[model samples]
Target: MAWHKKPKTNLTKLRIVRMIVQIIMFFLLNLVFFEIGANWLVLPINMPQTIFSSSEGSFFLLQRMLSRAIIPLIPLASFLIIGGIFGRLFCAWGCPFGLFQDIIGLITSWVKKYEPTHSTNNSMRQIGELITGGTLLISTFIGISVGLGNQADVEAAFGSFFEQPWAVLSPAVFLFTAIPVIVYWGVLGELFRIENLGSIDILLWIRLAIFIGAIIMIIYIPRGWCRWICPVGIIMGRLGEHSLIGVGRNITKCNHCGICEDVCPMGVQILSHPAERVRSVHCTNCLDCIPACDEDAMELKIL
Candidate 1:
């Protein structure tokens, strides 16, 4: 009698599960601001809190001779530790902005097929790197001048200088702040007895433009923001370069098919080696490749 091979677990299902959980957590984090300690812990997640401020703090510390507090370091430490072990799984599974991109990808797919070409993907990657570098440079300069030193006056000078550039540039900011404000003021204004929510300003328009542009890009290219312009992603990618945990391929089972590579949103060449740990910094550990391989060749392993 011939033995039948048992069906492999659908890893993509796990990705979906993570997305669902992230969606719930994302909304809760924004809507319900509960404090764990005296510090007002602000959503135990790193992206929403630290991504905007980590670089600024780092640059500030570098510029100042003053002793720094341990409180500020906690977020950066948490992000680095998790990223080093899990290879940016948070970007794929936990980031609210990442989930927003995934939703756009699904919606766009229904209307039209948008598979990114190799050259296009490379160009996008370069653009993302440029944006990340520019942001860091600007933040560092500001931190050095106004965010630290004896001349420091973040409350008075920094706001006038930077003018909330982070909020204007960040999609997460638009989603959590602008969207909520619009909904409350524009949508729920009639329902509730409230006055003077304030009119949308030019900064809000800029945020709207950034938000819309990001959505359009994600629809055309999967994980477009993550691939090209997210400073947080750049930081995480660098930290996760030598991640202890990653996807591995089974050489004996692999049939040399390119399905895994094709399905990869990050454009990682996963099948380049017959069997080896995928150490690509771009690998988000989404495990989409696992379900793509029919022969049960790809597996998530820890070292």
Candidate 2:
């Protein structure tokens, strides 16, 4: 009798697919943001409890669900739980910031030989987490304070909070849209013929600088922005825990080759230890590991 052996996993194909999807979404978001802001086809909206301040944001889904009070919190709760389980897949496959990093990575590659290195420092990342915590706490306070006696008061208070507090600290606006406009026009545009342009709002500049600085940090490491400075990422990371959806690693049949870790844009240690547990909150669930692994040791599982 002949012994049978399984084939090794190949990741190039999978990474290509993810890269393609991210690219498509990035372009689409750019168009959507432009249409809403420049063409006025879609009206601007706000999230009553925006995790952070961003002019272009809304909690439409959350607001509707919570307002009715009929549908159990299970739905929203399920979403967070499932998302966390699968790693922060949304950030890798869906977030505009992730897409931006991909684009910038391309630019940096062409301009010079930039190695994909890890941003080892965790202090800046901690600060981002603190800011996100503060935002959530304050938003909750505003929600409770305004609705102290009546639903009408709660609605009014939430509305006021979103308009003022949330719009200002939204790192997404600066990271995804504002600073890109600035540097693309200010530095990269002048040097290259790219259609890069940016705007300056004195009031928004300070927060904008923080986001821009995050991107600059990316120069040292891939996904430095998402890893260290994004509040949106912070929100998603928290929600990811207890998520019904997740990936599992088959460690018994495994070799400890580090291919999966190498491909991880978010800098997670995928191949180390028992495969089932990936502790880094930054895992984007991009599945870059599945294809990269030669042993076919990884699979996605739902709890």
Candidate 3:
């Protein structure tokens, strides 16, 4: 007559550490008040801002560079190097967008997070792939046009979208630049004074719509944009699939309870990875699974 007892997950310490890191990185990535001259040093993150943000995330720069007929060597290199070494860990530790989503998840903790089946989830991830491919194609088209001296024609057609199509629709731009610009310029107050709703920019309304949709997605599905929408995430996930640093399992302690997958924001099937390396492409190295495993089965392994 013996009974087995499961260990409880200790989310407190890891959450505190992650929150501190996210906050510090947000400020460093921002620094809107100062011209730090760090734009040249693009990191493989999806921070995504232009005017106010001094730091450039690799994907943002990629879109901009390609659209301008520039070969984005630096941004591509940053993605390869960082994604190779850290396996998208920056998303967990540094991305401001990730911080926002995590905060939303926290606020809506009382609501049960939506959990899609594996096949369904995999299909949903294709949305990001399509977006990445489509964005790159559009940028490539603009680049070729610019390189061929047809910039005027292209600009006449696409206008601002010819410069940076994705950023025009980016939710992060709304969060980081649009909102601040609105406040700083007193545009909202002026609009309210006149009550001129039609005067609002169409792009602003579109961005606001997208931003609200993103917030709602994260609240319901937790990291929904990261999982199913972000073009940058698709690239990072592909690189991170075979990354050096990752979580591994201690088979001796593991009872295969499947708790690790429950808490994963990216919906990775943790147990499916090799015992010594849980190298799932979607893993941001959040390490939330490590604490969730009551059996103490998971460990951060680096090679």
Candidate 4:
């Protein structure tokens, strides 16, 4: 007796669900402001500020020292614990910046009639790794030495820098601060009859350049910033090595089609390895692979 082949799963449906969830989360975090009972249960995680906060906390602790100042632990700890359990799902499913990139990427793909290739160049990936690793190392060293040291003059010189270095130019800053300011000054100012909107500075130009560059890169390379330069994603990726949850494969069912690898925006070699689960630091737990697999071989598992 001949057996019939099982129908392929329509992963597009799952992707739609994820997209809706991402949209709701983005708006909720950016728009909603409320409290629960006596506790402020939900609050927008300021993406740029949180990146600096996490780095500072990790640096001080790693140096076998404690910060005299009260460093906010919620964002740092949340990234660690959540990443350790679910990998970089937050980057895939929650980051406003990530959402923005994905939207643009989809549009680019539609217009170009093809999906942009994920950066698979070994040298490029290495450069990305170095950038993220170097940022952490250098930041930690400076933070521990100059910011925390007893040299008052030195500390004062680097104090503000430590507070937020590249953060002012982050995409989050552009989306949250720059856009709003531009609208208020450029558009609303005319209606309000407020002539003194403020002068553009060098820093503003730098930020605009960065923002525009990021957009162009995202259009050409899927998840360009997260894959190549996001220090926050790099940190979460390191923690994800020991994540309790990951996408696993049923080896027997896999046809070795390489579709999963193709769909992966991070260019993970999902089929090249014999490991039962995808542990690639780049895996965002986006589950794009699940839908890409026509053989029904992949599933998320607790491991």
Candidate 5:
């Protein structure tokens, strides 16, 4: 009798290379973003204070390319023309926020017994998108108002209940970094904090509430905050819809086994009427589905 050899499944070196690229890019972009926030922790630059706020000088780096004496049509043209032509591979492969969500999802996965699911109704996602869109629009208005030397509502809003709300609600600085450290120090132990944790400029009660809420959401939902409420995600979702880089599906190689659907962290229906397409605006483009597919049907492409 011939003995059947069991196949060995090892993570490919290519996957390792991709992981390294992802990690390096994640840290590098974040370092850039942080450095732009302040200069040497002493002097500040004229650049935007935060990435997502309507602060004094915030600008999407890519969006700045729109207006040029020679290439006046390039910016908006690229934003609209590039994304639909390609899939949203940049979001999956390069976005730092996506990387953070992936890490948090992994941490929560170990403790989670069952997969968390949610309603995929477009209404919910639309509402989220609108809130995000409105915030950005309002921020831009504030920026113009400030630039024009008008500061009435801005000052009033800051002094009213919002009170440095940007610091407390910012997903970039507070959600991923500040809240976790504070929680670990205050509740779980000193394990997460390795040194003298910097004092947060937020009220203790507000900080405590955010910490508790984050813990509850992580356990109950996979990337709940990012998927449902993050203003950054909302903006990215819009950009991803027409991103120049994206996942291309070859229908000839696909068998529609629904495996990709199960693997998607955002719960997008992969085997649906889109027919060789997954234009899911809610998609973070994380590439979790590519490895899960039995057939070599999906590939990252530049359109």
Candidate 6:
């Protein structure tokens, strides 16, 4: 829960630049202030869009389309094309949730979050893959069920979980969509029922618990949700693990000081990765390691 020892690193230029990009993307994707109307500009980011919203990440769109028995051609294409070009770059620079985590990381940087060894970190990433695939499978199953006219059975079994599995409990989704919808619809009046507690949906409390749990995890471990549980991250990682755009280590100028790894919220082992590029799926192309290196050992690589 605590990083007892680590190398000190100054706030780097790349980090600041990334924060700027995160800020810009945050507003652009939300469009809540503008209300541009519904559109299909899907991308590989961790954004949540409601029916009235203008944007959505490919992962959610994929589940939604599949649940309706649609092929989701555009969303599928968005994930591949964007992930190919940027890898998890959207996760780092464009995701609103990523921006939120960056703010938390900045605040907690003084105390420092615990950094797991690369091996342990890598093992934990399997959890994300399972979540990503599991959600997709559920979506596909529901699609098939709906196609077979088993609507009642589907609702009986899934309820809120029908369209989006993990997303029903997704922290970003709850933060961005569920919360707003609740407040706007005056759902608070239903929660207490003042007379009867049985009318309350247990899922509501469970969703809030998950949302809070994710935030709590990030406070003690940087990018904990990204590294361990984001279904969108795993999907992008699979589609873009060998992406052309990524971080590279300049071995010639490198001294293996470990500052880059220490600064990396994802706990990427920069020293062990290939000098030409880091191909780890866990890497979000954050470029945080760049300025952390005093030896000028880190740089961006374009294939």
TM-score of each: 0.75, 0.64, 0.92, 0.75, 0.63, 0.89
Error of 6 at 115 (Å): 1.3
Per-residue error (Å), model 1, residue 68: 10
Worst 10-residue lDDT window for candidate 1 reads: 61-70
Note the Cα lDDT for every prediction shown: 0.61, 0.54, 0.82, 0.62, 0.49, 0.81
Give, for candidate 6, the lowest lDDT window spanning 10 residues.
1-10
**Which residue runs does candidate 3 get wrong by more than 4 Å?**
1-9, 32-35, 38-40, 192-194
| Candidate 2: residue 133 Cα off by (Å) | 1.0
| Overall local distance difference test of candidate 6 | 0.81
> Can you write out model 6's per-residue Cα lDDT over 1-303, one digit (the tens) per residue?
133133334445667778998888776776656776465568877776764556788888899989878898988899888888889998888888888887987787776567787787778889888888888899999999998999789968998888877778899899888878878889767765777567667887798889888888888888888888888888888766777798898889998877777778788877787899888888898877886677888898887
Measured by TM-score, how close is model 6 to the native structure? 0.89
- Residue 183's lDDT within candidate 4 is 82
Ranking of models by lDDT:
3, 6, 4, 1, 2, 5
Residue 82: error of model 1 in Å? 1.2
Per-residue CA lDDT of candidate 5, range 1-303, in tens? 111121113223333555677677554444544544321211010122343222221123211221111222432343344344533344445545545555765567657533444454355566557655654455555555545665666646644222223334434445545555556558535533546245533454465676567556655666565566654455556767666665657788988776666766677766663544566666766666676666877666554
List ranges where model 6 is wrong by over 4 Å.
1-11, 108-112, 185-198
In candidate 4, position 84 carries an lDDT of 79
Model 6 root mean square deviation, Cα atoms: 3.2
Q: After aligning candidate 5 to the native by TM-score, how far in Å is the CA of 189 from where it should be?
A: 12
Q: For residues 1-303, could you state the per-residue lDDT of candidate 3 as single tens digits?
A: 011123243766787889999998887776765766455558877666556576888888898899889999999999999989888898899888889889998889889788777676778989889988988899999999999999899889988688768878888767777777888888777864656768777877777889999998888888888888887778998899878888999999999988788767788898888888887767899998898887889999987
Error of 4 at 249 (Å): 1.4
